[model samples]
Every structure is written in C-alpha cells, then in structure tokens.
Target: MSLIHVNDDNFASMVQKGGVTMAEFGAPWCPPCKVLLPILEELSAELGDSVPILTVDVDESPVSAGRFGVMAMPTVIVFHDGEPVEKLVGLRSKAAYAAVLAKAAALSPESPAAAR
Candidate 1:
C-alpha cells in the first residue's frame, strides 16, 4: 500500500475517520523527510489497511502542520480515534516508527490490532 498524501484541507477528516492513523509532516526540501518517505512506504505496505499512513507536506499544508505544532521537517504523529497519542521528531529508525504504530494501534479501540 502507498502512503496517502494529505493536506490542510483533508487532514482532519482523514485522521478523524477513526482507528489509528500515522501522519508524517514534512517538506519537499527536507533531506531527512525525503529519506523517510520510503521507510513510511514500507511500513504502509507492512501494516496494510490495519493502519492508515499519511504524508503531509508542511509547505503546502501549513495549517495542518501548525495545528499539530510541527516545528521539525520530519515530524511523525500517531493518532488514535482522532486524538494525537505519540509523536516523533527528526529521523528515527524504522523499528522506532513501527513501535510507535504498534502502541497506537493497541490504544485505539476501533483498531483490529487492538483486539489482539
């Protein structure tokens, strides 16, 4: 599965749809953000539909970025049931992101992963 691209317009709606959602707030000029893209893509495929992974370009979605207080270029926020639960700033290991997703999935009552 490919990472869903979101913007200020649809960011809230997409995350509020329910369950656990992982959103990466980044900018096109950010080298780390560019590097992290493929990692997120791999995670998106590994997690399948169990978790919805989204990408937001900070430059284009300043409203959403500012709403989340995303000061870094590659800030990853995990939301459960429309609420932010965990956040990671800057570059992190793929395993670190996976761990955060696992935690978010377990916290969301609507997530199929939560029942496991």
Candidate 2:
C-alpha cells in the first residue's frame, strides 16, 4: 500500500486503528526527509498491503511529532497495536528499515492488518 499522510487532525484517529504501522515524522524542507521518501515508497511497494506506512510532516503536525518526541528531521517510529515499539532517528538503509518493519510485524502477529 502507498504511504498515508497524517496531520494533526487525523493522526490520532489513524494510528489508533492499531496493527503494525510505520510512521515517519519529518518535514518537506528537511533534506534527509526528501531522501527518505523514495526509500519509504520502495518499502511500501515491497510490503504491499501487509504493512501500512504513515508520513507525518512535523511542520504541519507538531502535536504528533511532539508527542513522539521527534527532535530530528527524519524520525521513523515503528508502532504495533497503536503504540510505539521502536524509534529510529536519521537516514537509514532499506535493509535497516526492513529489519525494523519485520520486527514490528513479529511483535504483532495477530494484528488484523498485518499481512502475515
């Protein structure tokens, strides 16, 4: 599935749905955020509907970013069952992201949205 954009208005509702969700907190102006976008797209395509990816722009959604304590531009938080399970800061390789996603999936094998 494609990345879903979450703002202050929908962030709560979206993440509250549970399951394994990879939420990236960053702003468009952040250089690393720009570089991370394509990598996220690739991961999204690879995972398909198994895992859902969410993009949260810090500038536009300060509440969510602040809640996650995202001090950096590119902060990727792996959430399972609507709660953060892993937090990664800065740019990382696709393999690294995949590992995190795999861990998140492993943590919630019973997740309805988790595609095996």
lDDT of 2 by residue, 51-108 (tens): 7889999999998999989999799998887888999999999889988888888776
Pairs with steric clashes in candidate 2: 1-48
lDDT of 1 at 39: 98
TM-score of each: 0.92, 0.91
User: To one decimal, what is the Cα RMSD in angstroms of model 2 from the true structure?
Assistant: 1.9
Per-residue C-alpha lDDT of model 1 across residues 30-99, encoded as one tens digit per residue: 9999999999999988878888899999999999999999998799999988899999999999999998
Taking all chains together, the TM-score of candidate 1 against the true structure is 0.92
Candidate topping lDDT: 1
C-alpha lDDT values of all predictions: 0.89, 0.86
